[model samples]
Target: MLKKLEAQPHPDDANPLLRLTNLDVTFTTSTGTVTAVREANLTIYPGQTVAIVGESGSGKSTTAAAIIGLLPGTGKVTSGSIEFDGADITHLSPKEWVAIRGSGIGMVPQDPMTNLNPVWRIGTQVKEALKANNVVPKSEIGQRVADVLEEAGLPDAERRAKQYPHEFSGGMRQRALIGIGMAANPKLLIADEPTSALDVTVQRRILDHLQVLTEEKGTAVLFITHDLGLAAERAEQLVVMHRGRVVESGPALEILQHPQHPYTKRLVSAAPSLASQRIEVAHEKGIAVTDEELTGSGAGSVSTSEIIRVENLVKEFDVRGAKGEAKILRAVDDVSFGVRSGTTLALVGESGSGKSTVANMVLNLIDPTSGKVFFKGEDLSTLNSKDLFKMRRKLQVVFQNPYGSLDPMYSIFRVVEEPLRVHNIGSKKERVNKVVDLLDRVALPRSVMRRYPNELSGGQRQRVAIARALALDPEVVVLDEAVSALDVLVQNQILLLLNDLQADLGLTYLFITHDLAVVRLIADDVVVMEKGKIVEAAPSDQLFDDPQKEYTRELIDAVPGRKIQLAL
Candidate 1:
């Protein structure tokens, strides 16, 4: 259980723009009742940037939803009052909420993948928001849409405006949603995980834009995020939540430097952005963690084998032009790289840069337009169906979105055991035993075996996916943004788990990610890609210390909290 912070009094002269007093939120589910937010109190002064930081299911989003009066099914604020602009608004009808939603309080939702409508074009969606909120005249809505999209960091805004949500990549879709939310520039803007899907450079640009809005327009911003470094860097004030309660709330830098709560200390220590400089802190405390432990294979195992190799990989797609002329679009342009046995090779790039395409080709899920993939010195294309099926046991993949990757209907136990049962590896009892062991390896409790994916947090669901991937004891695991959706502490734990698994099982890893801060922690070798081409390749240390390419330097510089150093 998380201990609560000591009660503090609010100053009478400091008039906050938004204040919640003794807020208690509860939900009525089919099984029973659940308290999402218990006696939560928070305040945001005018034009001040405040962040609610927590892991998934910690009630950060619930508080935001309560403020917006948009709680999902059977959720309600049971007690206390929410005062906004000196008006008590604890219980408002749906009709009254409609008035405050768009013009008064703008919201950037959490999930970009499912937030936007699939049928509508991006520009149409933005224009609709503008028209509804009356942010701009109807005659100027078209130009305003383009302006907002460009401001949100989407290149070629005019062309992208016509594209549907499905046509854009995940990061692009997120930028579109951001454009919609910031279109009106409301007095109180609630941004929930706004930069979670963006690359480092784009994320920096977006956050900077928000800061400018706060400075110039007096837009009191409420940011909801799981990133500790981002919260510390972007917000002036911070509120840390754990298990549906606010554990700490104070100045961001003070909380980060001298954490009063145990949870806050864990967040500061486990954060990769801050952990980069805490090597000595780990040692002074008698901690044994070293950069070498994060690397794959022992010193001698590096000379033993090369598991996966890609030579001059090229992938192209033929798109018909407006005049029916064929145009060839090069997705992966003659990229060459190799993953040594029991080591991690990270493919880092922006969205739609062919990272996922390259991973798919390596997994043999999609055939490359050209080039060859050799697994254990065996060419993948030469294999017949039987050989391919046999080779599959040697290769596996864990995707980014755990909720999307997992089947909602299946229990955790069934999800892990299915792979074993399909392979016909053992009896039913043996499969059950294998699942229990896999869960243990992933640090998940046995009680979670009966729970469904929908009932678990993002981190818990990812653990279940990891357990399933290890069920086959594969030699290579392609982790594509596996921990991107988790909080800092959870991401740290997952990286450590991967390192340990590689040491014990001799597993080779092909890691695909956009976060360079994460790459610095877990990757042994880094291959930087731009426009589907390899621009830089070096060891993690060399690349971070002195990046060769201009693009690589920009990516490193854009990492949040590059200036601040954390200490105990």
Candidate 2:
């Protein structure tokens, strides 16, 4: 159980630990200078947690970068006064910034893969932070690294510290970054979407640890995220940014319950909790839900026929232990499930719970150690090579990271048209027309065909990926954390688009995700996994309304801001 900390004094009643006054940040490009943050002001008192909430390009992150003195590429603070702990730090020398970085103000960035060095061991990187900050003597640094990792919720810390970044899952890497950020015992911590990549249970654990830090050490936190629910639950003060300016700032609950700005109103309505409410209301009324509902709850009745079925699925991997001894790790053990035609089955679990592994087995991307996967009443393992090749055309997948999944070198047209070309599905001119139609269906402009994936936003890139997946006209489309990385607005757009596509195309979806709120909105059925086994399975409405297992209830409870009373 998480221990509740004593109430903190309101921000207005206390001296500010960090303050930003009339801040204006700009970036100079080849075209001209563009302001990223304009006349923004914020405050954080000691032991107070303040959140900056906004969309993807709303300048929340830019404000955070300015605070840390690490604004990227041609960006500068043109006008602002930044005061930290009674000291003016608007403009500091490189040496001065270095001296204050870890010891005074630490940061936990959003993407762990990019923030962490790929070639270095995790332990070495943590050690470097301690050494750079001079937090401890060299002799004690090794033990400190283990302690930090363990505190961040990584089990077997000594063994995990020796692993590289690639060896850790997304949640594990994020935890390691948190440990590094808190290692120096800084007076202030800046967490940028810190728990976005984590599962609800793990997110609760990490946030609980941070709350303990605030209670014991009086460390102030400047939390930055696109999640309003998280902002409402974790912060005492909320600063809402839109189009490079602060549109609203006040007590977290007050702003959330009675949002003043139009943008803030949109954010509150688009949040997953409210979206789920819309779904419930629609079902209760027996009314057809429109795309505007953003709940994806109108995908027609599920067929009795099973499009995909798995029985006694087992997957195992051989790995070396801390003592260098070989052992077998069963990733998926006796997992069994079925997806009916024209319906969405959500495979939900925390990282390393074997959900993705099960998806891989279903797709035949990897061979299972035992058991069978049947598609259309045919066993997959028994198919010949030629038959397997033919079957692959009916199965498609959209990976989690749009930036990684979409090739950088390929134009949008080629990326969508490649599947058609590989299967010899159509002529050159026909494929061109098909690609254009697919792009339109996913809500991208026809002109986007000429642009590359790197030029588009995360949401646009995902639309392109969906276009590619549909290019094959597959029977089952596996979405592996497809909308997990996007902001709330973009996520709602993508979910609505998916629902429209599924209804129109009669697509069978195997949606794999760790977010139960999203599952509540998009999934028709839910399968809960933990430690490679199924703990519960039920219809979406039943599971969320009356969860049978403790684990399932824990996940539902862990959803941020579920208990908050919103005006919507």
- The CA lDDT of each predicted structure is 0.83, 0.88
Taking the candidates one at a time, how many backbone clashes does each contain? 0, 0
Model 2, 1-568: lDDT tens digits are 3322223566465778899999999999999999999999998888788899999899999999999899999999999889998898999999999998988998999889999999999999999999999988989999999998987778999999999999998878988998899889888999999888788888887787777765577778899999898887788888999999999998888887788999998998788855665555566677665656646643435577899999999998987663233478889999999998999999999888899999999999999999999999999999999999889989999999999999899999999999999889888999999999999999999999999999999999999999999998898999999999999989988998988898899999999999888888888889999999999998887887789999999988788776555443
After superposition on all CA atoms, how large is the RMSD of candidate 2?
3.3
Q: What are the per-residue Cα lDDT tens digits for candidate 1 across 1-568?
A: 1112222234779788899998999999899999999889999877678889998788999999999899999999999889987888789888888777777778888778789989999999999888888888878888999998987779999999999999987667877887787788777889999888788887887677666654666778899988887888777788999988999999887888899999988888777766653532454476765654333321123434678989999998877662344477789999998887888888999886788899999999989999999998999999999999889988998999998999998999999998888788999888888889999999999899999999988888888999999999999999999988888888878888888898888788899999887787777788999999999998776687679999999988777766555564
- Tell how far residue 89 is off in model 1, in angstroms: 1.9
The regions of model 2 sitting more than 4 angstroms off are 1-13, 117-173, 277-294, 298-302, 320-326
For candidate 1, give the lDDT of residue 123: 95
How do all models score by TM-score?
0.88, 0.90
The residue ranges of model 1 lying beyond 4 angstroms of the native Cα positions read 1-14, 121-124, 134-164, 167-172, 277-304, 320-326, 409-411, 445-452
